[model samples]
Target: MKKKINPSREWYVLYVKSRHERKIEALLKENNIETFLPLVKTVREWSDRKKIIESPLFPSYLFVKIDFRKESEKVLAIRGFCFFVRFGTEFAKIQEHEINSIKLLMEIDASMEVENNHIQPQVGELRKIEIGALGGLGCEIIKVNNENKIIVRIDSINQNILATIPSSYLTQLATV
Candidate 1:
């Protein structure tokens, strides 16, 4: 018999315990639940030398593709699983384009850096990258650090991740 795919299933983002993303992912997979955990390769320092490590792109966050009408409880029961990301009282179902954009961001070369600055800037226009790797995704230009570095904000999981894009790669989008 072939496994049935439920059309009602939707992708939802779940908040997990800090640094336990991989563990929760493993547990969910072991239980046969579909999960997507985006990771980024970063270099870490130690007394001996530098070592490259794979870190969660959005720390403490993971996505699950499941039929929310039935499988949400199963997801909540998993260890380290917290509440679903919500915008008011209802669960926020992630769109396919958002997931695709994240995959695109992850596949791009080491040019992208995770933005850690919590300060939200009040300036800059929303623009789409039209040139290279980040092409076609909508982003907000936060600041122009110099001629070569322009700080840009990319949205993920109802939050923004900042990356410094080379000036030539950005094209200003006219806001109407």
Candidate 2:
């Protein structure tokens, strides 16, 4: 039997308690609510040893695909849920493509690597990251090391994470 789809159900962004994103996601799923908490696997360095852990890509935020009219209160009742992000009087809706994009980014293995020396360019060329963890972000390629490793500054996220992506994944922006 085919399950009926609810046309009103859309992806909505929610702010949850700090450090409680995963817990809330588990709770919502137990209650039969569809939730998406995008996470990234990274190496965490400690004084003694290094540990690889999965952390939320966007801290304190998760998306729920639900019929807001019927399930808003149920979502709010979850202990860690803070509130829905609002755009004017209405709750902000996340485009389906954006959610899919984030999922695709997390799936990419970019070998998150960084070079110590900061490369500065006289004039930087703007380009888009077509693949890897920082996909969809616009970066300025400041330096290309032997044509294999290029230094780029991702301007969208306030703090940039260093990752090594193949140059073939980059697309040069045409001059406007």
Best by TM-score: 1
In terms of TM-score, how similar is model 1 to the real structure?
Answer: 0.77
Where model 2 places Cα greater than 4 Å from the true spot, the runs are 1-4, 112-164, 172-176
CA RMSD per model (angstroms)? 5.9, 5.3
For lDDT, the strongest prediction is 1
Q: In order, what lDDT does every prediction score?
A: 0.73, 0.71
| Model 1 RMSD vs true structure | 5.9
**Local distance difference test, candidate 2:** 0.71
- TM-scores, one per candidate: 0.77, 0.69
Per-residue lDDT for 74 in model 1? 88
**Tens-digit lDDT string for candidate 2 (1-176):** 98688888998888889999999999999988999988888799999999999999778878899999899888988986799977678787776666765676678765544433433222265666776655666666655563333344422222244445556666766677
